[model samples]
Target: MIVVERTFTVTATPGAVLGYLQDFANAQEWDPSARRTSRVGSGPIAPGAHWRHIRKMWGVTTELTYTLIAAEPDRLIFHGRSESATCTDLVVLHPVPGGTEVTYRMELELHGLAQLATPLLRGEFEKLATGGVTAVTAALDDLSRPAGLRRRLGAATPNRLPTPAEETGI
Candidate 1:
């Protein structure tokens, strides 16, 4: 088994960070090795939510089905399985004075003959982990920025009955 962990702080609330990370499909946005990721079914992002992820590393592509195994106000856990490997990812969030501190950890366990190469692959995996951490930090920083005027107004506005002109095409 190989594990990599990173901790970083961002100027986003813990709720905002957890909300963003809970959607596994967002991995594609921050994971350098991810080629594609899509949710299996869509309703709400909860513990049972799953995502199909295609990742390419060292020129070899692998597909994994990742399930949200656990979720809490300050933490999330995901389990991913592929033909040759199983991965567990844990994310923890803590509120800071001005933002949130996040800790991300990933553990990979190889099966069968693949385990033989685990030691040799550690360096490369470490590089990927570093890149992923940088990407995630950037993503969260962007998330903390205020939205554009239109977007802010859109979200603030409440739905109301259409104007009288819309009731009759004049």
Candidate 2:
């Protein structure tokens, strides 16, 4: 078994932060470890909502299915399993002085051959999880910043802006 946890202080309110985080489709936007994520069921996120994700780790691609185990306005817990392993992930949001305190934790169990490689794999997994947290934190920060400031700072610039068509010369 391996576990990793990270906490970040984000400028957004807990409700706002959780709203974005709970959107399964947004995982790829904030979670650096996720190559892609898609909702598997219809409707909003709630208990029993399922998501499938492809994540890259150690230069290998892996797929997992995550089922929402618990969902509250301020907290969410999910369990994910692949054919080869199982893991639980918990995310908590707490109101803070300036913003919100977001904590993410993951616990994983390796089976079969994976178990044999656990000793070598644990450290890397921990590092990967930590990086994911950092990426989320940074993304939240960017999201919380004022739009004007974000534009001026050239951070997280959007992909397209309307441009006037060039006049044709006769």
Who wins the TM-score comparison?
1
Q: Any runs in candidate 1 off by more than 4 Å, and if so which?
A: 149-170
Candidate 2 minimal-lDDT segment of 10 residues = 157-166
Model 2: per-residue Cα lDDT over 1-170, one tens digit each: 98888888988888878877776556676566677677875776778988877788778798888898988988988898997789898899999998999988889998788788778878887777676767777767766778776522213422222222422432
| Residue-by-residue lDDT tens digits, candidate 1, 57-159 | 8888988889999999999999999889999999999999989999999999989888998998788889998998888888787778877511221112112
Task: Give RMSD (Å) of candidate 2 vs. truth.
Answer: 9.1
**For all the candidates, what are their Cα RMSDs to the real structure?**
10.8, 9.1
Those runs of model 2 whose alpha carbons end farther than 4 Å from true positions after fitting are: 146-170
- After TM-score superposition, what is the CA distance of residue 144 in candidate 1 from its true location, in Å? 1.0
Deviation from native of the Cα of residue 47 in model 2, angstroms: 1.2
